[model samples]
Target: MQQYRNKLLGKGCCGTSYTQVTEELQELIFNHVNREHDRVNEHRGSETNPEELQELIFNHVKKDISQSEENRGNLRMTSGSRALEKHKLPSFKNLIDLIIDDTVFNNNFLQMMGGMTSLQSIEIFSSDISVNNTLFDQGICKMLHLQHLEIWANGLMGTLPWCLANLTSLQVLDISYNDFMGNISLSPLKMLTSVQELRLSDNHFHILVSLEPFFNHSKLKNFYGPLPIQPHMSLKELDISINSFHGHIPTEFGAYLPMLQTLNISRNALNGSIPSLFGDMKSLVFLDLSNNLLTRGIPEYLATDCTLLQFLVLSNNSLQGQIFLTNFNLKNFLYLQLDGNHFLRKMPDSLSNYSLEGLYISDDHLVGTLPRWLGNKSCLIDIIMSKSHLEGPIPLGFCQLESLEVLDFSENNIIGSLPSCFPPSSIKQVHLSKNKLQGQLSDGLSNISSLTTLDIGYNHFESNIPDWIDMLSNLTCLILSNNDFQGEMSIRLRKLSQLRLIDLSHNKLFGHIPPCLNITIVTTAFDFVFDSHLVRIIPLREEESVEFTTKTISYSYRGRLLAYMYGIDLSNNKLVGVIPYQIGNLVGIHSLNLSHNNLTRPIPLTFSNLKQIESLDLSYNNLNRKIHSQLVEL
Candidate 1:
């Protein structure tokens, strides 16, 4: 292979024959030139000296040399040009950047790089060749002094090669995810107009390309797809998302791109509305129109002209009225998703006018009340307004948010209590389950200590199960189910060593039950090597949800499969005795409720090791004997 890439660039071995190759292609050309000189001396720049510029950009680009696997079982790429006419191939004048990835491109390997006219960047990817598309105009667009071209995911099918308009000093044209279909004619890319990063995405085109020929390009900055064009007011990232593009959203694209910054036309079939000239795009920053079919509402000029807007996604659109936080100015907003809209009222006490950090107005059937100026939003962190029929209380100025962390007011009608001034150190998930929230439980919630999900289930919470909730040592879901909670369930709840769900079901609790509640939390098999600490203690709540009442309905476990939901629901409580043989040590429980408890079961044969039981209720309780035949194969 070109005298083993010119003897790994110390050029010697010129007249050939260092035993003419194959010591596994000379140890894959000296381990890809010492792994590209240790990846360009690991990004040099300590005032330069990457082994004196790693032989000028590591011999000017060539990746995975000879893609080895023992020379692909006897050099096959149609093993034609008479098996590379007995070696000695590589000569590309003085390579100016050539990357041949996932190798194998035939026609004698494109006639040995068609004598690279001092090539100026040519990337070739071969998805196992699948040859015959007329060998890309006799090999790599006849290299008219090419200027960066990437042939990606190379299963390149027909069309799209009208000699790439003679390469007109091309400036990066990435043929993306290729299988290119027919008729993509903008008159052969209109004399290339100095194409600036145009990636024809996942091809299967039929585009006639008239976005006024990309406004006669003067450096189109990043344009993907031939779909519904418009890019090129010196574009700055415009992703024509999942195409089949329908109407609206082209009111001269914010008066002509103006260095637009990231606009994704999400999953299209896009219908009207949502274009108050996209609030006059003042260098807009990330605006994704989610799953379209959009309608009105949401146009106080996008918070009064996108002032450096940071991530505003109009979620699953249908978008009706009312988001008048005094015609927004967004103050550098950070993630404001108007979730599945139909919006009418509520949520606008000028929404503390932005210092936001993730606020998704969920299932918008929004009604009045929730605006206690949202307790002065101190850079709020995650407030997903669920089921949106928002009602009273919760605003003891939300203890000034103090960098709040995920508070989802579920199925709202939110009544009083639960704002006894909390901010006890960055709260972690407090989903007000099916709200009608009545009091108790707040001795400043044991000062929060980074709580992991405290769901106030089926509302009206009356006191006691509180021993300051065992100081929440990172609790993993402690849902106060159908409340009216009466005393005695605390054995300091085994100090919650990262609990995996515990629901005080239909409470009025009478003693027993907490036999170290099986000391929950168990995921190991090296817990997938702590996948970023289990995605930040189970966060990946896609469109938020968290209700899991077994057998008596309520499933809903949103995201990351709610971290593999392990469970415990002290069903219909008035709990008396027995049942807890350490609750079968919980063996990674999957729902096990002590049904209508006056519990006197001869049950526990350690419940036959639960083997991750899927719902076992032990009905009405006081069982007089028999049945523990290892719980009869569960």
Candidate 2:
């Protein structure tokens, strides 16, 4: 094999003044590396691990490119997105295992792997690999020694090739999250008697013929497929979730899978009652049957039947009954999720027995005061009890949860002042919106210095926005709308440069819009707020909007397309003044609402600078004259 090596002799003559890389150059390098990796990995199946190959290529490219950049000296630079080229492979005969993720796959890549007959494991994920019926005839069937094959999230289409049955030596086969449609025959899967694990979930396989094909596979340890299963002793893990499997769970499920350790049948059409025999599965560690139609209360036997269970999730079911935790062996329990159910009981006192890490029982009819015993679980990290009808004050004992990170009590009737029990500097996200919480914002909130989001909107909070809010340097979102707050809009808000979204509308405030709310200051602060809350709201990207009563309409923006945005809403307030000319300095402000305010003056000429403004509402204001021609163009 030919070897390629290049050594840099010394620094360039202009070493003291090396040129900083331009965005264009960085993007060019990124694209080059990505294309090269794709080409190489598609052609070569090598002894060199894919990760090592990437490092070798990067080191080689950086060394040769850095010296050239030094010669270019100073140049204008532009901002660019970050990129990471996936590691790749080179042709080598004896390669055993290949795992590639988050890379676009093509037909050539498949052809390259087809030649690697010695491979034992092959896993590809989050790629664009298209697999049709011919995939097996081309190369996959060549891997007679293949033990494990997983190709997930690759947009695979067409029926699974029957030739898969030829790979009888297969132990594990996972082909999930693809576009495969129509009914799939289980006959081929049945032939793989040596298979230990199988996952065909998240595909469009409408109906599976029978569980008889799987019954004979005594070596099957993990199964995630349609059709009711008569489990075997070797089966340890099973997940048949997000399917159309309906009817009552078989009472003998525990007896069939005697050694089962993990079971998840959530988000299915399963109805009827949960099998009490599930508690008898001694070896089971994790159980999840959430988002089902199971009725009646939880079986009391579960507490005594499964001693080793570490994770139990039964949220989003129709189960009804007073939840009591007596006699439950919760010593080994780590997580408990009973949210979105019809359990109309108070927070169970017995839940405090275990040292749990997560507890989510939201959207249920749990009444009375917040459980004080929750403080005993010092190891608790996440607590989401949103929309639960729990009333009264938050317990002071909750502050003992020093490891807590997420706390949500939104849409509840919980009354009283904010509790000071939060573990200082530990919480990251707090949602107390749409509650009856009253009184001034507590100084205790300042203790949680790590808070990134704070929403206390839609309450009877009668006070001024606290100055300490600016001290929460990491805050990216602050929502205090619909409160009885009365004060002039605070100039201190301008100091919070990281804020991306702020909703203080519908308050009894006065005075001019903050002149410092211009784009220059906002753009500087928002530079660090990219990629923060973009993922969860992607579906709403095109119609990116926030609803307010200013214009009695929802205004939309371009969303992530314009990643850095600035907006201000000061409508329906007791303000009286001319719109500030400084507001025009906010060239990047996308939405500005100042309607229904007692302001008397002509619109400022500076409004012409709002080139990027998408939604501007100045209705119901006592404006004297006609709108500016330049502003009209905007």
Candidate 3:
């Protein structure tokens, strides 16, 4: 077998390659030439172009060039190099950077790459194979010259193998999203005196407390996870967002890490009142104390002194008392998420010329009408006020929000007809479920051809299912359940092939189960989640969610896993006729509920094709011989 080796560069020239007397080995490799990566902007930052077709390696690197379906010339670090022999290649060492991106290869090359002493950067992104423990113990630990190492989202499991004590030359280390479990300590990481940026987010590591270990190493700049309270002068961004951090947030945070521009201590077990000293950190840009056990009111200084603060997320906390006081500056504030709190306020009032973009204060016991000041927020994109006690009609002034995309007033006491002028043209998801709103939905949602989710369920809206409903070509979810609606299943729903979840259940309707309801959005990648439409975040924003009752319980589905959930709930309605055989065409469906409807026919045997079905509810229907034997197998 021919061996693949790295061809290192020396100060703008080709440094060395092994050809004359090296061992004959066969391995897929990226042949990067000196000063040529800039020509291909697609591979601009990477040291080697990942899409190596049949490109020939430099003179001393390789004589024979080959290509195949699996490798694609990616550097595969499989274990046990070819049997050593003379006159072939001695010990080829000069692999500088190894970037294994979306390539089918085992991660056993670490120890092998250790021979290539010149290896500096190793990035393995979007990997599919299991990374074994020898990855650190044999390969990376020996590379004292390696500087940047990133193994993001590669599905690596188990506790971190922290043999990285001698790499003093390392500057950047990112092992985020690896799902590595750990009571991992950063005490060993402090040895890398030259490290600047360390990202440990989305891992399962319970890291060390107190930024005390790195307090002495003056160059650390961006730290992602593992929260500790300590003073580090040069540290600009300190993140302790995902961990088992307990106890109260020390009030001296402002004095400690005085240069911190962004602080994220969310998703922890810490409880206490908001620290008053945070306002003293004059350079603060983003502050996320959300998803904590934090309680009590906001400190006055945080509203007045933290002038540079733009994004504030205190969601899922027990924070109470009045919110968004007049002292709160609105100049640079972009997104404010105070959801899951008990703030006893109606809405933020002392705002006139605000530039807020996304305002989410759901479940805050907010009462009264949505303030008229809301009309001035021209930059508004998401307005979430679900599960509140807001009353009266949606203000006519809401039409002024020309940039509105998500208007979720779900689970509120808001009544009165939706004004024909409401639902601006830019709306994508208008969830007015669980309200007393009454109106012909068509009169309001007529012009919105771009709407994707129209959930007006659990309201008093009454009208025939309009033909224009099918005109919503991009509709992914159409939930009109538990509403007063009389219509035949006459609309052409099959035209909405992009539909993933449909719930017209518990309403007044009569017709055959639309064979077209089985119009499958199923594809090879139907499970892929769409890109989050919320532009700015606490690095946070709500994604689309749908509530469907299945197996006698309502479940709300959202986020990444929700992508694979295909459900159709047409139960509890006045419907009649044979269950269409084509309904079984929804082979990708996970939940199919057709109970509580007045129909008569044998259960379709074609349902046996629903291999992905998780819940099949066909109760209370007048139908059927025994269930299909194949479906019983499911």
> Model 3: which ten-residue window has the lowest total lDDT?
37-46
Of candidates 2 and 1, the better by TM-score: 2
Clashes per candidate, residues 3 or more apart or on different chains: 0, 8, 14
Task: State the weakest 10-residue window (summed lDDT) of model 1.
Answer: 49-58
lDDT at 396 for candidate 2? 78
The best-first sequence of candidates by TM-score reads: 3, 2, 1
Ranking according to lDDT, highest score first: 3, 1, 2
User: Compared with the true structure, what per-residue lDDT tens digits does model 3 show for residues 1-634?
Assistant: 1123433222222333221112232223333322322111121122222122111223222212112222223223222332223222223465556665443344444445456566687776655544556577767778888898887766878876657777888998887766877565544676777888887777777656677767656788988767666677778887777677888888887878777788888888889998888877878888889999999988888888877877888999999988867767646778789999999877767655568888888878888987778877788999898988888888887887899999989999988988778888888998899999886874557678788888989999887888767677888888999988887875587788778888988888888777666457853357463322221134556766778777889988886656777888889888899888887777888888888998897887888888888888889989875776776787
Q: Give candidate 2's whole-model lDDT.
A: 0.66
Cα lDDT for residue 73, candidate 2 = 22
Candidate 3 TM-score over all chains jointly: 0.79
Q: Which portions of model 3 show Cα errors greater than 4 Å?
A: 1-96, 101-108, 125-138, 141-145, 152-166, 176-188, 200-209, 522-525, 529-538, 624-634
lDDT of 2 by residue, 37-122 (tens): 22211111112222112111111111212122331121111122211222323443565655554444446556666767777777
Better of 1 and 2 by lDDT: 1
Candidate 2 differs from the real structure by a C-alpha RMSD in angstroms, to one decimal, of 9.1
Q: Model 3, 68: alpha-carbon shift in Å?
A: 16
Instruction: List per-prediction Cα lDDT, in the order shown.
Output: 0.67, 0.66, 0.71
For model 1, residues 242-359, the per-residue Cα lDDT tens digits are 6677777666667666677877777778788876776767888888888899898887777877789778787888988787657677668777788787988776766566676778
